[model samples]
Target: MKRIVVLLAFALTSCSYFEKQVPNEQELLQKELKAINWNQVDEYPSIAECEKLTDATQRKQCFFEFLSSTIQQKLDTDTLSVLYPELDTIEVKITVNPDATLVFEPQFPQDSTAYDKKKIDSILRVRLTDLPKINPAIKRGIPVKTQFILPVIIRGE
Candidate 1:
């Protein structure tokens, strides 16, 4: 009985050790995209062609096309008109805290007359584990700070 119990424990431990390390879908997609160089253009692939891409790099590009479509659908004529009342552009700086916490601040428009001050602090929060899978700088419980500048252009309707 003692030998049988020990054998069972060893088997379970060994199985845990051999658990395969598989990359998540999103991480895989990011890797594939990073591996390739893509040229940016005003026009993008059609929905049907995008859905057909199987290669990691191609699929990533396709996904971007899908995202743009979704955004267009969400922003109707009225919302777009208000958000972009004139031919104006603004730049925003997003800062992420080093301690694995999220921190976002928007740089107000210089004129303060083009767009509203409405901005969300965190559009999406990725989990700690997820970060490691994408960016090498990210780790479990490690503090990191990052800054990003985004220019939003609004064309008059």
Candidate 2:
């Protein structure tokens, strides 16, 4: 009986001694990346006007300043006669393509603006066409595309 009990214990212990596979270097790298925030980039894309700044924070600020100024400067407020007094805010999704072209996507509340989508697209395209090529953002030393949602206020005179 003691011999039978010892053999059963050995069999149970041996059956439980399975090995776990260790991940390879590439698999380990991918697993580490899954823990990171992809939204944050090492370097932001810049325009010609923001190229002078050397510090990372300053460069990012300058890029945003230049972008906002460009949008505000190019908007033809005189052509925007369909804005409601209370709801004058229009959200513009600005995407800087890898090749440096600008795309303006306007989002307005249904009751906010009287203008149709086609009219708004036309209005924004004209202003966005003048945007210069942008240096793409960098992630781990590789260039990546970036975008921003800008709120634009249009007031009627």
Candidate 3:
């Protein structure tokens, strides 16, 4: 009985010597990152004019509205209307670069004759260049490039 007790005590004492392994700095950092909420952004990127707004939702809305209106104003649909009076709609995607540069890409049409891309891009580039510098998107307070999908509706009336 005394031998069994000594063996059990020795086993229990040995267990204490086998300390739990500690994770490395990288592993700890990875665990912390995994615990973070990626879906939530503390603040959104906004134009200089909208920097004053504190609410994230309002700031985002203001940014989008301002961008859309500016693009709409720059669109010279007058000539296009004359060419294709029945032209209905054109889909385009705009990407905002980290440096606040604007890139417009018009969706290619299945029928070539149905639209003119080079002319549209030239006009777009000129207009975009003439406009003021835009603000880039923000993720975790860092500037990030973002894309905006827009539909350009062309109507004669």
Candidate 4:
């Protein structure tokens, strides 16, 4: 019984020693363990940086320019199905009020689904304009609070 107790104590102590090599309070407090600054000091480039271009048309073009063609196609398909249904195109008019609130208009074909109008507008506002880089140009009216039309084809049928 004494030998067993000694063995168990030794095991517990060694286990702690090994665990001490892992992340503990000391490592967490050290400067070497600082959290990532994703913007300035990381390889993972932000979408805003990727989309930066000289003009609105070029900026829109940049949205399609991705390092991976597969991801681009996926984004295109997802965008089509999510933003357009029962229509081959969509016209988005985002008007910025003098008070800085946005007004969204999603114009669909006459035969399009009776999608929740406010919901559709909300989705565009949150997903497109609310992006960190997209807001400034939109607010400043560089692209201007105006109409933007893009084609969308229903996938697989």
What is each predicted model's overall lDDT from 0 to 1?
0.45, 0.76, 0.73, 0.46
Arranged by TM-score with the best first, the candidates are 2, 3, 4, 1
Best by TM-score: 2
RMSD of each: 15.0, 9.1, 6.9, 17.3
lDDT tens per residue, model 3, 1-157:
9999999999999997899988899999999999877765455557888888888888988877776677666665456566667666666788878887778887766776766788767666776666666777767677777776777765565
Q: Who is ahead in lDDT, 1 or 3?
A: 3
What is the TM-score of each predicted model, taking all chains together? 0.31, 0.71, 0.68, 0.31
Comparing 1 with 4 on lDDT, the higher-scoring candidate is 4
Per-residue CA lDDT of model 4 for 1-157, tens digit only, reads: 9999999999988986676445766777675446543223212122465555656555545543431232224335344465555544445554433333445566766785667666756555554543233332332222323223333333433
Which residue pairs in model 3 clash with each other?
Answer: none
Model 3 TM-score on a 0 to 1 scale: 0.68
- Alpha-carbon error at 142 in model 2, in Å? 1.5
Model 3 weakest 10-residue run by lDDT: 72-81
After superposition, the stretches of candidate 2 with alpha carbons farther than 4 Å from their true spots are 1-23, 81-87, 110-113
